[model samples]
Target: MNKSLAASVSPALYSSKTNTKIFTLTSAEHNIEVGNWKIDSTQLGILDTYFIIEQKILHGGKQEGSKIITLTSPNGLTITLSPTRGMSIINVIGQDMRFGWDSPVKEIVNPAFINLESRSGAGWLEGFNEMMVRCGFEWAGHPGLENGEMRTLHGKIGNTPASEVEIEINETAPYEIKIRGLIKESTFKKAELQTLAELSYTPGTHHFTIHDSLTNHADYPRDYQIMYHSNFSKPLLEKDAQFVAPIKEISPFNDYAQKGLSDWSAYLGPTKDFDEMVFNIVPFSKTDGSTIAALHNKDGSKGAAIEFNVKELPYLTLWKNTDTEKQGYVTGIEPGTNYAYAASIEREQGRIRQVKPGKTVHFKIKYSALMNKEAVNKVKKEITDIQGNQKTTIIQKPIAKE
Candidate 1:
């Protein structure tokens, strides 16, 4: 048990009565591995007893060697994180609702068994059962060739394991719990990129935030793209479910999507052999550049939403795959620096972002579980206010160079 005092609390915010603790679950450099650990206020002299942080490793089939961290918040929100899979969130259970989809891939397949380049570069699908999975550090989009190199689907970050993971407790009033991981993607003479992924939540709240800082460790500049594929299904995603956002522009991603242009924002019941439809959107942001997108059930009573800074993530991708439940019926509300086109096409469209040597870019997003009509209505009003009087530009076809 290699526990240490964390210095995250500022002097002004630090209280003599509180004890801030940091638990190192996995750190190769520090030679620490506190396996199957759990902590609560009872062990820290804190008043909040409802919160718990637990870490364990799965040991069977493809999930073997995968490290899982479960954070049970005071508000009854439980988030399951997979450090072995780029710290992707596997489940968000709260408010008597589960926010993730039921994917055919039942196991949280460790990166060791995942072949990101298999199945025509779509092997990432084999381990894609997560509420939210990141799609890039180098390139994030459809699989395609770039300069004769095949860029696999959604890049390799999600399949890359985190080298270090730790749990930090804020001790002061609010008592925030944070799980941080260091994920890196690098190749000799090609690119060197890393991101400090942090997921934090205050006690007694239905909301949690993901704050990630990505840095280019290469001596030269590197191009990058990232998309947060936040997914939802059944209970929160029923037939006629509405994908709501304050849109500045919207367009179909391809001919298949164009056929569903009129019903793009509306979801359908799971059908046999239903192909997915993708839409590209530029969301309207508030004056400070903050924006939100939400998916509500048919009656708008139950929902889930994501808030992000549009300046950092300037695009939204709506992915509707209403296939039969057995085939994985789900939808994705993705926010990213670019649309999910092939990297080459995005580069031609001037959407691929870049970072200089030793420079880091920051991205922050908040995920909320809307438990009732009141909560869902509040978000709807926020989006309505952002829309003001602007008319959304709807394009019937893909705009990028495909």
Candidate 2:
């Protein structure tokens, strides 16, 4: 057999026409060549997976100075990470199912992706939505800084950019790929904090997982806040879509949501100048300490689900916006340690968390999608079985937006 053609054949099987006995080498440690034939371990069918990673710089726009790294899987999963923007997953595509929202801004590569520049003292709302945006290490709300500096919409971490980015691919059995990045948030004479985020995925499965560790390297104890802000839009979040979560109780952020309390899980069509609603979901986790939240179309054609550890992220926030096209209609599934209130409010509410110097905290979350009825049922049953038919109360409060 020709050397090139024999390389593709199963080494365990003999080609009678070749008049030679075959021996399969399962290990990739050997480089045996005989009579111009080379035995390649990768072609032994040990694993079926492939991945590609690319780093590129943007140009011709405000984001021109920005940079991004993209990781794609052979099984139809593509993720774009902004190392210059808190290492956030700006875009996600998988199995004909898209989970991220379409923001009013068209790009995530620049500071212009952020909406408002000046602060009006209202809850910070100038954020640019991405597939997954990290919220904080110091404060994640709209109140002014401790030194009286007006706070930006979201925290500064999302705009801080990563320092050391690493990518690894292993073609071993149960093939996997991982991307790790380090981001730091510091002040002039204050404490410094760092977050190391690792995102991993396996081909042939519509799932991805995140593992993060935040460390407070300051000499004294410091307060910290963090959240995983994941958004969904369009086809999966269409009119009549349903939301399922293991909620123990829910609190509406304003009167608009109060009036729509009965249909908190119901989605409506976009309207002109529509008011956005925010709901705080107190979820119940399974015995393993994990909770689940999901959304699916009315006809169950497409959907997405998320699982997180309640111990790490006890608070879940649901953001619903059905405004006009220009304003952008979207929904967000947020899990964090604190609510999306002013830093002062969170402090007063005793929801802010503190980390001992030299101590590290870990957070993990998993994401999967449903492309058909079978996948939908599996997610529904999992959530139902995790939390029984427990009814909870909804508190109503009002918030303002300019």
Candidate 3:
């Protein structure tokens, strides 16, 4: 694959692969004093049996970009960082995941893919997340030609620049980490900001905010094709899970969306009843937590929940696995300004964020578990007032525009 293809998919935000290695990512005397938080890159490097981020550190794929970052836990959970740089996980110790996949066999050789016995606790992804504050994807494809069966990706990391990464820890508290990054091309050089933020869960009470500062560094003019790729396991999709946003429609990921990242001309059916999955940038009816996006399993034993204000994330990309030949465990619940191959659309509409040589751009995202109807009603009332009985266009829920 080309460099742009690799970099574009660097962080495998919604990947389903297996790796087993644990690298020691020790903590430093960090003193950013961002807030009451602990930044322990070492502990952060540890993963549960539940999930892992696809960093593309091992088993090469096509050269997607300059670097790639991935995370995985013993519990069969994974978050990939190709397009983005970081991820934030919550309440991990409670799930039983597939460990046989990420663990190594004692062949007693230097396995390129991953080695759990040599590294820390199979948390190389997290350690790498803090090792340096910058990197990109390089190559991506199947694990190997003859013997390798795993489809993997690879990239260069923090080795890109020199900047201080902060990690602080407090007993029974939410941990916070921060890193600074940059991207420079021929006529542009802009700073890329990222953070792994977490707030103590309060069941259905508290909300968490994620922030980033994206700058366009081109000397002349530039356009930023920004996308937020969020990943969660299949078990999270509960019967109550719904999608709500300011979307116009959803395009399916048929042969078109796959071959070209921006292709969305075809509308594939909901992947095996996974209606929350879409390929096009669909319209959402989210006023303040509208159910425009969803993933529910009616069975109700295992499920996922989501509640976000559409004002921040206007576009979304819902991905699910339907190929009988493929097997994976997670789906993508992405909220962003651009979808695959849809960057030019935002640029043409002047929605693209541009940055000059020393400029900065800031954006924020907040997520939390929703309460009962009363809480949703309260939010709805506030948003309703904000929208106010307007005789405006009424776009279909999660449907695309003409």
Model number with the top lDDT: 1
lDDT of each candidate versus the true structure: 0.87, 0.72, 0.32
Query: lDDT order of candidates, best first?
Result: 1, 2, 3
Ranking by TM-score: 1, 2, 3
How far does residue 283 in candidate 3 sit from its true spot (Å)?
Answer: 4.6
Among these predicted structures, which one has the highest TM-score?
1
Of candidates 2 and 1, the better by lDDT: 1
Tens-place lDDT per residue, model 2, 122-177, is 32244475788887767775555555766555677787766555544444656566
- Scored by Cα lDDT, where does model 1 land? 0.87
Model 1 per-residue lDDT tens digits across residues 137-221: 7999999999999999999999988867877787776788878888888899899998889999887788899999898999999
lDDT of 3 at 27: 18
Clashing pairs in 1: none
Model 3, 95-190: lDDT tens digits are 431111111111111123333222222222322222112112111111222233221221122122212222122212132212222222222133
lDDT of predicted model 3: 0.32
